[model samples]
Target chain A: MASVNRPNKQQNHPLDDLIRKDRIPHIWCPGCGIGTIFASCLTAIKECVATGKNGFDLDKFVMVSGIGCSGRAAGYVKLDSFHTTHGRAIPFATGLKLANRDLNVIVFSGDGDLFAIGGNHFIHAARRNINITVICVNNLNYGMTGGQVAATTPYNAKTTTTPAGNAENPFSLPLLAYASGATYVARWTMLHTRDLTVSINEALSKKGFSFIEVLSPCPVNYGRRNKEKPLETLKLYQEKSIIKNGADPSELDIDMEKGIILGKFVDIDKPTHSEKYDKLYRIE
Target chain B: MTENTTESRVLTGEHFMTGDIACAEGALAAGCRFFGGYPITPATEIAEQISLRLPRVGGTFIQMEDEIAALTSVLGASWAGLKSMTATSGPGFSLMMEAIGLGLCTETPCVIVNVQRAGPSTGLPTQGAQADMMQARWGSHGDYEIIVLAPSSPQEIFYQTITAFNLSETFRLPVIIMTDEIVGHMSEKVIIPEAGKIETVNRLRPKGRKDRFKLFEPDPNGVALMPAAGDGYKIHVTGLTHDEKGYPVMTVEAQAEMMARLTGKIRNNIDRIIQTEELFLDDAEIVFISYGVSSRTCLEAMAMARSKGIRAGFLRLITIWPFPDDQIRALAKRVKALITVEINLGQIHREVKRCAEGKAPAYLVGHPGGTVIPPERVLAMAEEVL
Candidate 1:
């Protein structure tokens, strides 16, 4: 099996081997937090597998992504990956996990890719309790598409499409996921690097639909339009973020002014899609 | 678990069954273990039959959220090392177009059953139509070749469904079984052969070390072997145009290389893929060309014309796409007229006309398609020459 843990000190960075570094100096802007969030995910996977905390099989690990800035993550990862169509990653990954139980399938995508166009698939997969990990980067706007207002864009935030102000209310991702029956759900900002990484590891280790929503910085598009600089937003997250584990998901809707509620909101045991399916169809 | 004799899963002996039920039995006989589908009007019985029979045969059936997800899940199951399929009608088949293109681009092998019904947009739900014939050929938004089979009766559909699976596995493409509502819902006697008697083809599995397996590198036959998710090959499958390594190359050369193989595999093997049935064309003055439910009407019309001392012949298409143009060209030279009978306005009739290409006076007997084209209409066309 291919090992994902070995540190290559000569490469200037430990994750250089896990990354398609030739495609480096990536398309993401300098202040964009996609790189950091991606790095944290790699670290989480490496730690979970290498430390033997989980008997994860690297060979059977597959990463799937939809079209967007974040969709490019699949092409960079040096494992079995699928860069599927726009807004269809969840359904595709759901199929992959259900088709083969041994595969540790993970869907890595963006806010517009998930909550906007892919909302139906998201609700359905969670409803079925599929065993797959979903990491959504909420940059508050469609950064790659010239900063259109997204489903998670806070009310009154300015975007290219919503220059006056976003009149639409944002969806509380945790509440939506929890209500849809996700077995594990959490929220964290990109500034909480270590905590976000740990949450990714936890979601990976869980046996049902697990979702982690990461608040990321999109300086070039989102930040410039919204008047919040990248570094300033990180500092704001540090000051205003409150860790409240086991809080009611309904109460954790992100409020840019009051504060951001961050922590694991839901984690409960449930027989996953394949578990119940296999048990019912057991060929004895 | 019981040892996979690959025998008892097959249902044998003769029985009275609908086209939908025979279709399901054909898939089970072909060693298909995964089915993902939605419930649509005429095609719903296919999902119903497969749902009940698949569990008994140790197979999996998933009723996805929608038709898009239905075909999408089947593609996923195919990559996970299962012979998978999905069934839908016109509206549902339209919803699956994007994934069909994805399946074509990725060269994923699976079967799709479109029990075609009337529709420009859900025109008639419970009735029959051959309107989707052209859509089945050029439905998805790209340039590529496809393999489609249209079965005329329940017995023929049983055999055609198995052949659809075999060809899909052999060529690494989605094979379409385009049976219409008339053939789909009608009851008839279908004889299923024993497992030992039936021949099924499985996809080529890569051998030697997993590290050496380049996922899209073709064999001499122009088809590459496949590796499942856990095969240690660690292949990357993307919908983007890709190179031989199965990685997105995003270059013109990569697309040309990929498209060349994708379109070439079936084209080069056209001699084997296109199947047709010719009846009494040896000394005929005019030929009536048809397929699916329409072909049955042509058979009756040909006999009616011959009884009137008119020399009329019938050419039935079993495989429509990668069309039997060569046969039509050959017959066009000898026949005085070539007439096509179809339920659709002029879907396959257009193909027949293009292939005939003025060598003969090409004509059509067509309808908007709520029911099968009657033999009386075909006989009327045949009487013109007599």
Candidate 2:
């Protein structure tokens, strides 16, 4: 039988040991940054559970996913998890949280699911700041089915669907989350696993909607289209990504020539969507 | 407690009623503490009545921005462990389809009433139609099952609302009350039975430590014991194709098993979930199969056909999916012909045809949402097909 109490600082919960090490040579192609993002999530969950004085109950958490390669991360997790329809993970997680206010709800989705099909839910959930964590793995393209142009695809990035180059501009997720009123908003790359893990832990500990965007790699879809290998992609992210220790989110902006700046962009206080709903309903 | 006599009851009179009002009262009697909805003509009365009555009983009610938000808010309330519901017409229901799928995949038990009107897109809003029957079954893409109940009278709406919530809780699946404009607006006396007498279903929760809990772990009956958030259970649940332990499984074999279990719950329990009401069919040569308000016309036309010496019969669908295949097939074998009468062009008629499958010819009598198909029209179709 598994222990239900919070874990002590020296011991990690069973979920930490559930990751298949043999599969450690991740299926993600060399240079793809997704491997780093995946590692950060693993590291964060392990540390969160490890710090508990008693074993962290794994059953009280649910990880939700939407359509995209990043969405597949929910499958790799050995926890109560779900991989739902495209752009709809926010709502699905909302349902799970509503079903039981105690479940630690987390969403791992692709840019397409978050900004395209599920844009409404993303904004409303953030505006409502429902007590859930959303980690958007932005590879700039729809990596799963094919490297089709996605809402996050950089303007002028070549995709299978974007023959001449993407005409539409991409959404700055950190800015969007900040504007939509997420209590916690941050951005990091697969290359910066340690920092990302710290940010992820902080986001997870927050009581309101916490959003983290991991700039990942799409070796097959986004990478191949750009004629970049996995390592080259990671190199691009590491070189092009502007790192600021604690950037002011309102002042941060992406430079096409420089690339996305990665850091904790926003962390503020407001009533979480659930808290407001609780107050509104006057639930004891 | 006093028996609900006409003068003493909440609402009284034996006039013709629509399914919508019955659903509202049924919800009230079922201990529904919260309702969040937007005003869409066919489903407007449900929100209207719930808003008016919920306050009297100290239940919460809100008119949300749209159907998507309506469902989102309801899901929010449901987590607070309140029995919650929402109602909508075509376009609103379409917007809600995504959330409905979410509810099912996550095993969140909540009731949604769709007073279907015509459309691929808002074809008719003010009028009535039963065009969404198929959408109710497979509108969301995935290998999951849904329970949809169709009511023929205002009386059945009251009864079915309780049944809808019960089934939703029992199976952890979204239960849909399929009605249309005609049934939604038509009013009649529905017996507001004593609240305690009406059965309500609650999800089974695990009793042991949160450490040993597997949110999606199957019980003896294959349904997982649902632990709400505040239960102190560390349970993980997701909409992805997951193993019995509730962990998402990426393998094709794992996906196949998960899909099968998700679908098989409803298939195996069809006898328990599927319901119907047959009338004047024992000695009839032709059977008119209908549901929602259309069934009323079928009954009227069947009576006229009997008067004309045609020996016609009627089959009223109380449960639309699982599609009443067994009974329809049995009747098809015995009848000379079966006519599926509905507001849409031929939505359920296709099902009737499939069930009949050469045993008898199935005919369709439809009126696109604008006008109700008159009883005489159904009579003509019955004569032609039979």
Top candidate by DockQ: 1
Candidate 1 chain B: 10-residue stretch with minimal lDDT: B1-10
**Alpha-carbon deviation at A89 in model 1, angstroms:** 1.5
lDDT of each: 0.87, 0.76
Poorest lDDT segment (10 consecutive residues) of candidate 2 chain B:
B1-10
**Could you give the CAPRI-style class of model 2?**
incorrect
- Candidate 1: what lDDT? 0.87
| Candidate 1 per-residue lDDT over residues A1-284, each given as its tens digit | 45678776566777765775654667788888888899999998887778775569777788889888998888888778888877788877876777788889889999999888888889989999989999999998898888999999999999988999999999999999999999999999999999999999999999899999999989889889878888888987898899998989989878867899999999999999877877876566
Q: Which stretches of candidate 1 lie over 4 Å from their true place?
A: A1-9, A21-25, B1-7
Instruction: Give residue A51's error in model 1 in angstroms.
Output: 3.5
Candidate 2, residue B316: Cα displacement in angstroms equals 1.4
Model 1's DockQ score: 0.59
Q: On residues A1-284, what C-alpha lDDT tens digit does candidate 2 reach at each position?
A: 36667567676444446453323434455555665687677678777777862344555656777777777676666555556666767865775565456677788888898899888889888887788999998888887777899888878889999988999888888888988989898888878888899999898888799999888888877888778887887787778888775676755555546576888877888877556655655424
True contacts kept of each: 0.54, 0.27
